[model samples]
Target: MTFLEKLKPHLISDDILIQEVVLHALHDYPNVPEEWTNELLKEAFRNKDKQSSIFIYVENQTFNEESVKILSENIPLMDPSERHLAVNLVQRIEPELALKYKNQLQAYIPKSTWALYELLLHGTEEEVYSEYGQILNDLERAGSDQHHLYITAKKLAACLVKKGWVTETEIDLILEEEIKGRWFSFNGILNIYMIGLLKLEKYIPLLVRLLERDEDSLLEELSATLISFQSDQVIKEVAPYLRKENSIIYAASIVENMKTDFAVQVLREAYTSARELDQQDILFEALCHQFSEKALPEINKHMELDYSSGLVDIEQTAYSYFSILGIKHRELALWRQVALERELDFRQKGNDLPSAPVRNEIRVGRNDPCPCGSGKKYKKCCGK
Candidate 1:
């Protein structure tokens, strides 16, 4: 029997046990027919005792607008866990619809702060800033439970940062308030503050402190903030970590953006220091493109080395370097000579090399040394 047929009986039933079974079935059979799917969904929603149906639909990729609207309307009736699931569903399928239900959603704010935070995160910056401002205003006007208000206030602070609305002075004020030692998660508050106040270079010291603390998921943000500076000082500070595998890409990216002669030199040195098996050719290409005139002699020297057996990779690498430097088109004659000589060497070694029309002026005589530096007669190496 098909999977849905097996799930059909439990799906139509009102038993709470059926909720788990339906959820499992949905998980196992994601492509099941909508007809059977809708029945199970309606059953889950109708059975107030079981909220697992909300989860089943949320997890299903096939769940669509009709299902979303039903869940969004019924969200007010759900308990905290179910409410969280409903909010997640709305955020996923219809964020604008979720925004429309914001007032009713606030009722669950004390218990579902993360849900509210996520909704605001996905909402437009204007909407989020406005909502956050209103929440702060409400906190100031009516004396509610300080704990809940503080949690919501912190969420607002984070939203403000992500939207780039918080000023440097505001960031300092928040930090001072956080230093007073409240029950809130200080790290989360500080992270948001850092992201908001990232425009000022003075905050680099604070970012360095956060990075040193090894706060979870903050390293990437710290790296991004550092990269934004795009100054020589920032590049020098981050240079030491380039040898580390995890830091290499970010370090290279920062160096690339710096666009200074020092950065190019560092990349060239790093390229030479890295093992041949390591993927340093891209870094070399980046350096070559950035410092074409300075790198020409080095490129020529490397191209003249013995690489008969590995000429294809070497040629492609050189081509990439030249291409990025915007010098390959001008150096076509030289590259054509090298390519012809390499092709001849491959043919002499019983390797199949495709024949193409010669388009360059550099003519390699039979007795001349191979351009590939294979250290053999041109006739034997590439002229065959």
Candidate 2:
């Protein structure tokens, strides 16, 4: 049987985690059977907690009139968030048809997902201010009960500044206060995110300073925002950090997200100059995510070196990166077939393994994405 044929059994399994993985993998394989796709698509919508996984399968669907009809039948059944993803997926599949179907999609209003912020934005300025004050008072009385709401407020505050809805004078004055505060705060990271969104070149230095702070759990937010600038200046200013042990993970994410030529060059140079195999592996993995054929030579060269030096047996590593060509080109390239077979073989081995237990019927590597849908590495989660 084909991989999807083998995978069909688990797509409707009671184990939602397997369903998520199978659905996510389907994105890399676009030719799913329409009837099966519709069945699973409706089932996924019924799962409120599935979040991103709900649409992944259908996003790759080759929609025909019948498929669109099925979607029209199901659109009204979804909540707004589900509707948003569903509508967005339809647009991606067939833009003109999606526009045509828009009117028929009941309760599919195009409101922002920020429900609390939406409330805050309504009414006259004075009324909004009074309501805002009441919200603050409620928050004070609610204490830590509304801590998540507090986080939303902070992120939205930064978002407002980015949108230029907040006045320049207020931005500068508040930033001055944030600037003077030397210590780390959760709000401060959100402020950093805001600064990156503003794309104000003067604040690049501030981000660089914070990056050097080497704060844990902050690198992802930090690198994502920094790379958003997409400026050559930002690339040069941050290149040195790539060499530091504390910062390579931050730099790897920057390389992965920033697809510009300079970002590629910086990573290639870093990979070439890296002294340790682990560091080289990190940089090389980031380069492979670029999916630029130009990096293939460096990747292969390093793979050969690692194997010869008794560092790592890297044949599978090379095969995996090569396999991504299928995902990048939107067709099942030859290596991707190899990947599907490899994954099936791996799974079958797990089923046959009698020596292991406690999630014994699972096969995944440490660096591989965790099957739990947490978007974390297996090593950091259930594999641990």
Candidate 3:
């Protein structure tokens, strides 16, 4: 018998497992008549076997207009768990219809879930803020589930941001409440970052405080965001991290993008003090792009090196500097010729070395030399 033919007998079997198996088997038969699938789902719902119906609807991705109609019809009959999934599915599948039954749904689903639905349905910002603002204020400190807190906070914050209603006083209140209430999480931090992006003057100090903790969790994202301000305070707060042995490469790149006098000084100092070639190259690239008078001295110093340090590759450094400095067309031709001749000389001097083999499964620090031996650090090469 065909798989569907064999599975049909179990649909009406008294055995619950048989009924579940039949519903699961239907997933592979997308070509099955819509009427047949709808009748099966309805039968499952009628028997209060909502789990089987929902599994097919949600997990198996078999939900359709027919499924929405069935769930909406059975909304009153479903228990809490069944009602939650049914309400969610209806809202997702056909939002206008979900709006028609919003009052009924409020009685079944969690308040947080219902609020998200209202937001998705485009409730006015003032209305959303009036209802959910107090809810966040009351519940945020009680250490509620990050899921509910995030869903509510993210949308509410976005509304406030869009309306230009966010203020230092308001931001302070939000931050103070969350801090006093201890509602920190990845989502919570992200919500604040979003708000901070909109209102930096009020929030950068708090961000600076978080960075000082040096937790390494979300540090890269936080630093990247803070540096975008390009303020002196932010530069001072972030510059020290570039000098850290472990954080140098990431901090270097972030500072590179800042492309300010402060950034150049930080990178130049770090490059001079750096013991490793990979770190130096990272500093080199950061400097080459800026190519200011302050940077030229460092570029000249590196270009004067006579031998390859396995990591520095002096000839490569000179080519990068000349290209970035906008050396004229004739100078470019000469540099390319000189670079090739240097490569030939290095090859003849037994100085050229083969790169290391790539490891299929090995973990190393970002600053560590890449195992593939391109003379680049792991972070810049294979580790990426």
Candidate 4:
């Protein structure tokens, strides 16, 4: 047998080290036939080991039409884990085909998972919370680990909460349960998703607690939700967490996504405090993604540092931002004109930083019919 064939049995090995060895060995045989690869993938699926040898195999190759069809047809027959991989592969290759078979796929997977994904994709906020409110409840009851479906469900829930479909009570319930269950562990993806999705001002205290955890786990997800606030107050709310010495890099990433003057200010503070060149470089790249004139002073500061130190990456980053702003070296006069206008705009809006407005209302009694027109009591519907 050839060297490639020698490693085939390792694909079904429960040992992760052996599985990894086999996967790496497969890469050395790039000229392996597609038909042979597909057959091996089928066998890998049938004899999936703890390391998910099939998932690793699938990741190594992009599927063509025939292979895509083969995977799609098998998804409904696969177990939850294999089905997850198949769905992700199909979605990566042909998203329309994934949706085309949504109903059939949903039949095999949990309804909550499909309902949440559908809500994110096509449903209105009112319809999602009302039509699929039960689905969220089912997920809540599933806790943070219901055979990996929780991760998919919670990610969809996070998107919904950001879009304002979830209720305050639901948010509180999720927080209380997750905290009690110690779902704050770094490996608890669903726990972090629920926390990140709980965007209410009242929950800021809870988020702060999680942010300060030694693990600094889930910072990215939390940052994305915080950016959804899109207000200066959110910068203040997140500032304390960013103050941690270890959190500077993540703070830069979060503020970069925010793209508001408030966000720029927060990033500036983090950049100033960041001691490592690598962290500063990350912040620099993030700023390039959302360039504005308010960023010029810090950009100039870094440019000078890079000039004195004979570094080029930071200078390149600044020029990239300039290029994005339509400023060219030949347009020095225009650059000055634009920069002054931006400075003026900044000064005018400096004291007028907006805060995320919260709306409080008199909630209905538990016995009342849900206002969502779901014909269910408040306790059994949106209020839950």
Candidate 5:
């Protein structure tokens, strides 16, 4: 078992030192199990030390009086970053409770944050829009960081557009700023997400032009935007990016989710023409994602060539990519999964190193709903 597995039982221990250590270790494990949710949240409030990762621990959880009490009582004990997160977390889950902390939290955060949260919770569209305007004035006066306003002011702006409150011209301007200001939110992914949400196909050229950008912060979002458009023009724009190290994963993902045989043909062609191992590794992975009779021979050929040449690092790279995919359980056929495992075994039996575990991590499983909000099974979309 890993250090986390060994220490996980102590996560809610009465002893603070052990719990804090375990809590810190929890950051390494992304999807904290549902059972640990309450205790971590309690510690998130109770711990005097920083627990900045409190957001991940309480991801799908909503607010309750119990959690609120714990958090409100420990607000003063939290570090600056922790306080920022606490305010955002509370505002998101239970904005009324966040408003209750406004007097206390204002000493630390961007101005008018709690007010915006309250408007979000209780105010009508008109009230929130009016408050949004007031926030712009406050931001200007303070010379506030756009990054600090994302969950508050930026969220309000997103809501305005989502509710059809913004004009198309206004949305175009917002899209430009959101995409350009990578640090303002979830990178260009969230920006492009607005476009996808609006089903704004005319802006594919805008996205295509921005491909010169290195906005790989969230491949799932970028991939979703491309999948939403699914144009030959998009596919054409993304094809060359398949060879680039930074962009290849989602470029390949875009091809995979397009779900056209032409997309498969593109991958096959990309693989055949590719020279570098890094380039081929990604192309080959996307081709394997297709999982056809054709892919099996190609997969085997790679195994035979690489393992026979004693390229264990190649296997290591593959394991790392699977981790990137965050694939809890691959949704392939029994034979297909075995084919993958057997290929790893092919490397292990010939080499001295133990086989890399085919990661059945506590991550998004292939059949799980896509986190990208695409409403398809992950395997059919981004995880494909």
Candidate 6:
């Protein structure tokens, strides 16, 4: 038995220190039996200690399947603070289980807004979405509190789009309500609007308005999303921004969205004009994604310059780019060659001598023990 198993009985009474220690130990060693974690949590709930409750909540946050079951069973009976923690834990660990207790959790929504937010954002299994729809309808009708309800609706809209239950039109209708009433931030509304446009690319005019109004960050995000639709109008809309000094980053991002040769040309020009490390890095990185046989010579030339100045770290970047493009190991032999050359040059220049050849030594003995670390002679073990 482990230390936590021995301390379980004492944790039942008032030995808070033992409980905390066992919890911390079990946290470090997650392989501990799920029953032990459940028992300690039950004891903490019986004692009504806030600190122990918090610890269990945190442990549940990091838990696997077995530990999550314990948390779900015990969460409803916990006090307000413990209940909130349990709700948050379930939302993260077992979202389906959390949805099972949605009605019971409704009372805590006002006090536990962040927990609700997490559930709406990431806890979006089918059951969780069903529960969210119920919650939204309930909040809308009852009018108990508007703050959490508005946030929940916005998140629900995003989740609906992701699930394909609601179309871009429905999302726009919701955003129209939100913007008119000043229910949420303009930026938040704009983000959801962009998501809508991403799904329904026909909304390019609206996106152009957002871009013209100086919403650069949102425009950049929208450009990336619009790439899936492969629309030239979107590229044209973002071209003027490409020339502006402040807008260069977003422009490069937009150019990456365009997969055509025209887009590659724009990226090459941007790479030439880009002076900052970050801008150059983004341009080169995007080019690597857009790489083709036709673009290889240009990439090779830029890589040579970057290597001489030590401005670009090529090996890691090349590996990442090739991995994304599904380029095989054999296809990237040129990159491996370049890396080997750089390593050799560094050794020769820095050490003032040619590197010695690496030697491999082989050993064998007929009557000796096997080199495989088995307690037997070579012939009887691996050699046999």
| TM-score leader | 2
Q: How close is candidate 2 to the true structure, as a TM-score?
A: 0.56
Model 5 residue pairs with clashes: none
Per-residue error (Å), model 4, residue 309: 11
Model 3 scores worst on lDDT over the 10 consecutive residues at 356-365
Higher-TM-score candidate among 2 and 6? 2
Q: Write the per-residue lDDT of candidate 2 for residues 268-310, one digit (tens) a residue.
A: 9998889988788777766765555667678867755623322
Instruction: Note each model's CA RMSD in angstroms.
Output: 23.5, 10.2, 20.7, 21.0, 12.8, 21.7
Model 4: weakest 10-residue lDDT segment is: 356-365
Candidate 5 off by > 4 Å? 1-158, 174-190, 216-221, 230-233, 307-384
Pairs in steric clash, model 1: 344-382, 345-381, 345-382
- Of the candidates numbered 5 and 6, which has the greater lDDT value? 5
Candidate 3, superposed: residue stretches over 4 Å from native: 1-122, 126-159, 165-170, 173-184, 212-217, 276-278, 302-321, 328-384
Q: Please name the candidate that would achieve the greatest lDDT relative to the true structure.
A: 2
Please state the error at residue 176 of candidate 5 in Å. Answer: 5.8
Better of 4 and 5 by lDDT: 5
Steric clash pairs (candidate 6): none
For every model shown, what is its TM-score relative to the native structure?
0.36, 0.56, 0.43, 0.44, 0.46, 0.39
Compared with the true structure, the alpha-carbon lDDT of candidate 2 equals: 0.56
Please state the error at residue 111 of candidate 4 in Å: 13
Clashing pairs in 2: none
lDDT of 6 by residue, 328-374 (tens): 65536666566556655544553553232210011112222333333
Where is model 4 more than 4 Å wrong at Cα?
1-151, 155-167, 177-199, 273-279, 306-316, 329-384
Please tell me which model should have the higher lDDT, number 2 or number 6.
2
Q: Over all chains combined, what TM-score does candidate 5 have? A: 0.46
How much lDDT does candidate 1 score?
A: 0.49
